[model samples]
Target: MHKPRILVVDDEPQIHRFLGPALNAAGYEPVRADSGREALAEIARKPPEAVVLDLGLPDLDGQEVLKRARDFYEGPVVILSARDREIEKIEALDAGADDYVEKPFRVGELLARLRVVMRRQQRQQEEPPPVVHAGDLVIDLPRRLVTRAGEALRLSPKEYDLLAKLAEADGKVLTHKELLVSIWGPAHAHDMQYLRVFIGQLRQKIEADPAAPKLILTQPGIGYRFMADEALRPSGA
Candidate 1:
């Protein structure tokens, strides 16, 4: 039986030294790429189930790798970076990575994150989600269609994806990290600005008053949640 494959894109020899055995011991096949261009070529040639990417690539920047990877690779991309700046994390997540791992991370922690992502991916494939409804809003997830007040609404791909994820977990507060990583990818999870921009756009289209949004409630310092009832928005929501 073939073990699940993982592509590790990092310039550091120590990263490979550390992760190679960890991945192998965890029952995964580890592949290595030392630069962004090499990572891209490897992905195109034989896609791995997941990607471990370092943001500072010598040839191509990590963000460019993610931008190009999004074209053909839909799998999870966990970013590895020593730069702990929030903006950096936001940029990577928005670019299309699945998770972000700060440098000097514990091997156990990295493995745990890998398992979480793999499990989420597997569960998603195993179950078919139900159509979503929130008063005037209607979302047919599988068809990638949405309508509000009995009228179809035009939305960009990213907008629709964000809405769908919100609708999928109706009434649940989706953290900024969760929504960003799930919709935009891990690299972008910290980019709350992108979330704000998209959420504002969504409210304008779906709410009777964009100024006073009811369907999509802001959790304040948390994330956003989709209220199933248009009229039952939480107090001060």
Candidate 2:
């Protein structure tokens, strides 16, 4: 069987020098691209199972590369960069990165992250159970429909995506960055206003009282949580 291919886009030779052997040992076939332009070209030439992208590229910036790659690529793209700032990580994630790893990352940790990404991707591809009921609203995942008290509720594409993401988490808190990246893609990760507007729109339709939402609860500075009912929550009350 062909080893899973990982496109490593970085300008640094040392990264390639070490990553090649390390990835090889980890059962991945590593391909190198020194610049964003080259990375794009390489991706087009041979589609990779996943991408390990660096933010600062000689020819094109990493975020741009990620956006462009997303136009045609559907696989995971993990941002491997030195930029450790929260905003930078948010930007990269919103730009289409599946995961972010700081430059001084441990090989074991990186490998484990890749595994997680792959597993999540696989799970997303697999179909889940048909419906979810949280409070008074019912969501049909396969049909992409939502209803409240037997009346169908209309929702925008983004709103549905956001709600579905939260519902799947089963009462877990999802960070602002995590929700934004997962729903709107990485580019809008920092656009809290967008989230606020959409979340409000969603509440108007799903919540019995938008003024005092019970399904979607704010976690103050951290993020938001889907207040699933005891029966709906994975813990099964």
Candidate 3:
């Protein structure tokens, strides 16, 4: 099997120095880009399976690079930056970032996120069964519909796509990359913010209590898992 390729876009040499070896050790081939323009150029030349994008670029804003990348590349994008504000994180996620990490992060966490993303991607390519059920929420793949408690729930295209991906995985955790690619196409494989917004929407429509969700569950820094409704029910009742 071919090792997954990851494009690391950062202006700092130190980032490349530290991340290259880390990614290599994690069984990923790392490609480097020092600026937003270079990153775009490299993507145009040949796209990778995933990208680690820095928000602070010398030539252009990292968000702009992310948007442009989504225009063509279909894969997961993990945003790496020094910005630690909650609003910034939310903004990036909404813009289509699959995941976000502040600077000075642990290599172990990064690798874990990578694995989650890739696993989901592999599952999607396999094209498993269309209809998926998680708890009370039932996803009708062909109709792009979701229902809970026997009532049809209206969902945006992106929201429906997100549910379908998670439901397909049953209870397995899906990384940000996997969800982004499955819904927004390959070009948006890195936009995590998009996932956040759609997830919020999905919960609102499906979860009995959106604030304290029992279904669409978050896995901290990793990703998300759609709890099987069957598992939530009492056995042999």
Clash counts for the predictions, in order = 8, 5, 21
Q: Please report the candidate that would top TM-score against the real structure.
A: 2
Ten-residue stretch with the least lDDT total in model 3? 228-237
lDDT of 3 by residue, 119-176 (tens): 5566667875566776677788887877887799877766777787777664555677
TM-score per prediction, in order, is: 0.59, 0.60, 0.60
- 1-237 in candidate 2: lDDT tens per residue? 789998988888998998889999999999998999888898999999889998888888788899999999988888886744556666665566766677777777667667656655665688644677876688888889999988898888989999998877644446788888788888987889988998899988888889987788875554666765542121211
Ten contiguous residues minimizing lDDT sum, candidate 2:
228-237
Predict model 3's lDDT versus the native: 0.76
CA lDDT of each candidate?
A: 0.79, 0.78, 0.76
Q: After superposition, how far is residue 212 of candidate 3 from its true place, in Å?
A: 8.7
Instruction: Output the TM-score of candidate 2.
Output: 0.60
| Better structure of 1 and 3 per lDDT | 1
lDDT of 1 at 105: 85
Candidate 1 lDDT, tens digit per residue, 1-237?
Answer: 899899999999999998999999999999999999999999999999899988889999888999999999888888887744555666676576656667878787777667756654665677744667777788889889899877889999999998988876534446688888888888996798999999999999888888987788885555677866422344435
